[model samples]
Target: MKHSGSLLIVDDNPDILIAARLLLKQHYQSVKTTDNPFDIAGIINEQRKLEQPIDVILLDMNFTQDSISGKEGFYWLKKIIEQDANIVVLLMTAYGDIQLAVDAIKAGASDFIAKPWQNEQLLGAVTAAFSHAKDKQQVGKLTRQKQGLNQALNTPNFEFLGQSNAMQQVFSTIEKAAQTDANILITGESGTGKELTAHAIHQASMRHSQTFMSLDMGAVAQNLFESELFGHKKGAFTDAKADHIGKFELAQGGSLFLDELGNLPLEHQAKLLAALQNRQITPVGSSKAVDIDIRLICATNDNLDQAVSEGRFRQDLLYRINTVEIRLPALRERSDGIPLLANYYLKHFAQKYKRSLTISDDDMSALCQYAWPGNVRELAHAIERAVILTEGDKLDISSVVGNSASVSTDEKTQSTEVLNNVAQYDTFDLDILEQRTVRAALKHHQGNVSHAAKALGLTRGAMYRRLEKYGL
Candidate 1:
């Protein structure tokens, strides 16, 4: 037999209670009813103590009055929601009081039905209410599960560890945006924790129960990007022997995080734009367009406006994807955050490596002075390295100070060389100098494209073109 959950119906009329019991008995394992509104809470509490709590409440409006006004029921609804926000309460209102029903919904009712409701309509509404309640329960269960798993996996703590005014504004903005279903575009320098911000938004949203899937657009190969995103039919390509579901399909009713979104190819951008505009997608080799419900959160380190002006990115697509834009400050720009982030990473790595280490004032000063071109990611790695290299509880700053001194020497030498070379010419070309500086940084990083690109303050694609132009 199918397992039918319990339900409680509250109304003052004995005939109405009997009718509700009969109507709901076919679907629920137990249909408890009360003709006295005063005893409703006691009955619910007693049943809950018995470990068979009500799954749904069919609350009648205007229990004491014959008139159709829902004033009395509204107060009961508010009480129920305040007492147990998890309980699903469906209002029973007259046809003329639909506006009142909507008001009840805003006050926290799961749904409402009118008097003289048809059997099919009533059943449908109740079924929908049950489904929503179950979904919420499932999400709560999953959150607990994730928390346990994270504990076991020993993931790093993710509090927004920053005290800068810019960071404060960012936090405030995120708090305001978390209450709605707006698509957010996060722009920042590389390693500035854009993905972390996306995770925070998902954690704060109503749909946090659903899965969160992230894809790095820059990492995906151009030829495979479409198949990777939209899935593929059996025999869609040479490698596809079976059907594959895309990220969009997997993130249905959840979130799809597109990191480095500006790196998406122009052709793929058009397809993505269509999906965002229509909430539907077609697979690589399929003619059928599958409907999807997803909240898109995109991040990019590149200047999207410049890409749009260069005709490499679509302007309309940008507008559609960026309903809300959040800019994350670079670590160097938010200098005040350095000490906090450094200490956070220190404690984190110390626990991971089973060491107890402390930073001296000199070490702290050295960290705050350096320009972190690699942002938080680099800082985290540096702290991990230091933790491993140090022998005692106190970290030594000699290595860090020496590295800084070497970098300074290299910069001064390069500056003098640039001045000497430029002074030989009557006219200095800014573009040529910029290209040379980009080339030198690429060489210094030993062709590690991403690091060199960051050092030159250029996107990877832009860096690649400069590398080719200078034949480096």
Candidate 2:
């Protein structure tokens, strides 16, 4: 297959230009020759306009103006690099001196090729130069992408704040662990702010200035596991139209946060273990190994110890990732922090919605008492929802959490009675049974969608769809 890289040969000798172009054109898609060295810039700009920027250039080291010393080649090379450092240049001269070759490389030329070069030698040099140029382009692209992501991530002030003793312990651990490069394992229930904790650690670490890439292990499909985390070459698979950089490569010299890590399949866990153990990854369909240097941080809601006992999670992999385990407490377990978190979100959403709103002491007390099944995330959603729905200046506790969130024993009994009545209406019809079951779950959980979804063995999204379908 012909390479996509465009090639240009610039020489005062027409015979040399013709000979080189003829040989390169067979291997490359676009090969152009120019006798005038001054036309290099215009040709490069024209190719870029055509959306096929010049990738490699072969320039004679000795032009008519400065034939012996190769001074003209250095000038043109400097000019070419200044135009775009990504464009690979191979300096060519009949009088090839070893020191001149070293100087050519130091001045940004990709390689030095002697004139009257063998066909094989010339082809090899151009191929290597093209590869180097492509690598440089990939690096440049990743740098820009990382910069944009960092900007977006840094927009919000680090809000991983809490005053509870449990959270204080977590913060202390983070402070100690962030100084080192040990892999960190964060385990907690859903909505417990595992990703936030990971980000906090990344921000506090020595790699704070570098990229912090977060990958959702559960969201990645089983078939795409290797390609997604380790990367893939162009034509690696049916849909792989171009060489793709994976999370491991993108997070190089930074931190990699693997969220929902317990959901990784047992088979894929082995591959992850290998990469973590070796500190390198081989992109899919490519034999070359790319070394990686990243601070590994993984979060999961699943009980990995139990998983290991059941042979669902590999023990060796767990040992590799869990060098420093930081277990985040459930919101109910750290109720002291609820007031701080609640007020923070309250003020935030109040400003966001342009409402002059305040939470009453009774509502704040109720928020602190409620057993938040979905943890801090649930609290945030509750505050945001209440801020949007409340009509009064003071936030309503009933609106913030469900009506039954901190109800008395009598109210709890009444809610149970309502759930019993909902179950009494069970019909054999699948739609009716499903709707009734959903309503009963919602009533039992005091209208907490996350808890109700869990009770019915449904995802939050699936539960929302059912709620919309039944208009409930």
Against the reference, the lDDT scores of all candidates come to 0.76, 0.83
Which residue pairs show collisions in model 2? none
Clashes of each: 0, 0
Compared with the true structure, model 2 gives a TM-score of 0.63
lDDT of 2 at 10: 92
**How big is the RMSD of model 2?**
11.6
Which sections of candidate 1 miss by over 4 Å? 1-159, 401-472
lDDT of 1: 0.76
lDDT of 2 by residue, 130-164 (tens): 99999998887777556545633653332787999
RMSD of each: 18.3, 11.6
